[model samples]
Target: MLASLLAGLGLGFSLIIAIGAQNLFVLRQGVRREHLVAVVAVCATSDAVLILLGVSGIGVVLQAVPWLLVVVRWAGAAFLLGYAVLAARRALSPSGQTLSVGTAASPPIPDAGGTALRTRTTLATTVLTCLALTWLNPHVYLDTVFLLGSVASTHGDGRWAFAVGACLASLVWFTALGFGARYLGRWLDTPRAWRILDALIAVVMVAIAVSLVLPH
Candidate 1:
């Protein structure tokens, strides 16, 4: 049991630690102090659902549906490409004003000047964004559910143990990442910092899309 748990933790961490759109979004939200809990919750829950499905033998059924994967692959590629273009546009666009970290020191507040209102908006946006990112990407399903499930299934009686371990790992990682990003956000308060982040995200997204579409 201990071995399985350790293995699951390793697997989960390995799969999620890579830089991706979802992680980038979560990090951004964390930095902005916008719905941090909601962002983490959505990410964690999505992982749970996918991990559960993968452990439950649904992966085999999905394997029989190659066309579905093909469609998803194209859709995911398009989404990534679109996001990349938007990022690049933001980078290139001229701005008359830039926000400085010193200026952002004011405590975050909603348009209504209430913490509650701000929190609500943050939560809603975070959940929705996570859902879209998780569900839209075909690679997520293939990697998390199908691939992981297939590997775990080979363990026979240990499959359940492995799944449990993976789930726990997911919970730990998202919590740490979501909250930890808060510290990083403090350092990235300058407009220049945001611009750099946006540009980097765009590059990463486009590169990943190209890799997916043109795999060797």
Candidate 2:
């Protein structure tokens, strides 16, 4: 039982620790300190839910209907491409406040006695984006649902123990990643740094989106 649990934890971390769309989004939100808690919660919870579904034999059901995955693939690609465009725009023209260590690049409002008004990404918008990043990616299903489930089945009666371990891994990873990036905000204080980050994000998004539609 202990071995199975450890195996699951190992596999879970291995799969999730890779640099992917979801991880990149989490890192960005963490650095910006924008709805960080909600974003982390959504990611962790979604992973848990998907892990549960996989353990419950939903993977088999999904495999039987391959068209479902195809639909998800196209939708995910479109969404990713859309986000890539937005990221590219940000990279090209960074207006308003950006991620900083202790200060934001807020613009002064003329009508408000020259007081700087810090604009932020709304909580609702952040949450929705987090959800889309989590659920829309077909790779998430392939990793968390099909791959994890297939591996967990090998543990026989100790599958639940493995699932528990995997769940814990997700929670721990997201919590650390979301909270830890705050320290790196200082590096992104300059517009050049911000542009570089956004450009990298756009490139990654486009690459992933292209890979999704390409023939395997």
Candidate 3:
């Protein structure tokens, strides 16, 4: 049982920590200290739910309905392309938003009676973007439902244990990534670093979008 759980945990971590768009977005938010908890919760929860669905035989059902994938594939491709453009614009014009760890340590300052409203708006926008990043991507379904689910099924009765282990892995990873990224705040304190990161995000998004549409 321990071995099965460990296998699931290890595989889950390997799949998730691959520096993809979602991971990058989470890390960026973590460093910025903006809606960190909501971002982590949504990502980890989404992973857990998707992995369990896959392990519970939804992968087989998806295989039976090929049209679903076709719809998802095109939709995901469109989303990714749109995100890539945003990333590219950001890269060209760095925001310098996350470069200062000082702002977080300091107490809140009066801001024309608009800070609270802005905070609420920012939080909502961040959560919605995280959701799109998590759910709108076809790769999530492919990896969590089809790939991981098929692999879990091979474990027979141990697949449930494996699913639990995978869920734990998601929790561990997103938690670490969301919080641990704060430490890197010291390193990413420059416009150059932010620009480079955004550029890389653009490249990654465009590449993945192309892959989604290309014949496989």
Candidate 4:
């Protein structure tokens, strides 16, 4: 039981710790300190829910309906490509606040007047983006559902233990990533550093998009 649990934890961390769109977005939000809690909640909760569904044998049902994956593939690729273009623009643009960070990081609250309204709007947009990234990606289903589910099914009566371990792994990873990103804010204070980060994000997004459309 302990070995199964440890294996589950290790597998979960290995998958979640990879550099991906979801991680990139979460890191950016963490650095900006914008809706950090909401973003982390959405990511961690989504992973936990998916892991549960996988362990509960939903993976078999999904495999039987393979067409569902095709739809998700197209949608996810399009969304990723769009985000890549936006990131590239931010990297190239000279006079935008897209990637500008602060030397002293402090979470910005809704002030008075138009500023508060903008903040609310930005937060809403961020929340929506997080939802889309979590739900739309085909790789997420492939990893959390099909792959992890198959592995979990092998654990017999200890499947739930494995699932719990995976859930804990996701929670711990997101908590550390979302909270620890603030330390880099001081280094990213300059536009050059921000541009480099955005550029790297763009490259990753584009690579994922290509992989989604191309043959495996």
| Candidate 1 clash pair list | none
lDDT of 4 by residue, 161-182 (tens): 8888888899899889989999
In order of listing, the candidates' clash counts read: 0, 0, 0, 0
The global Cα lDDT (0 to 1) of model 4 is 0.83
Return the TM-score for candidate 3, rounded to 2 decimals.
Answer: 0.85
Q: Compared with the true structure, what per-residue lDDT tens digits does model 3 show for residues 1-216? A: 777788799889888888777998899888767789999999999999999999999888889999898888888888878988987876786443233223443433233553321122267788988888888788899889988898899899899888888889999999999899999867776667777877888899899889889999
Q: Estimate each model's TM-score.
A: 0.82, 0.90, 0.85, 0.88
lDDT of each: 0.74, 0.86, 0.81, 0.83
The C-alpha local distance difference test score for the whole of candidate 3 amounts to: 0.81
Give the winner by TM-score.
2
Worst 10 residues of 1 by lDDT: 96-105
Screening candidate 4 with a backbone cut-off below 3 angstroms (N, C-alpha, C), the clashing residue pairs are none
The runs of at least 3 residues in candidate 1 whose Cα sits more than 4 Å from the true structure, single-residue gaps closed, are: 96-123
Which prediction has more favorable TM-score, 3 or 4?
4
Model 2, 157: alpha-carbon shift in Å? 1.3
Q: In model 3, which range of ten residues has the least summed lDDT? A: 112-121
Which candidate number would show the highest lDDT if scored against the true structure?
A: 2
- Candidate 2 segments whose C-alpha is farther than 4 A from its true place: 94-118
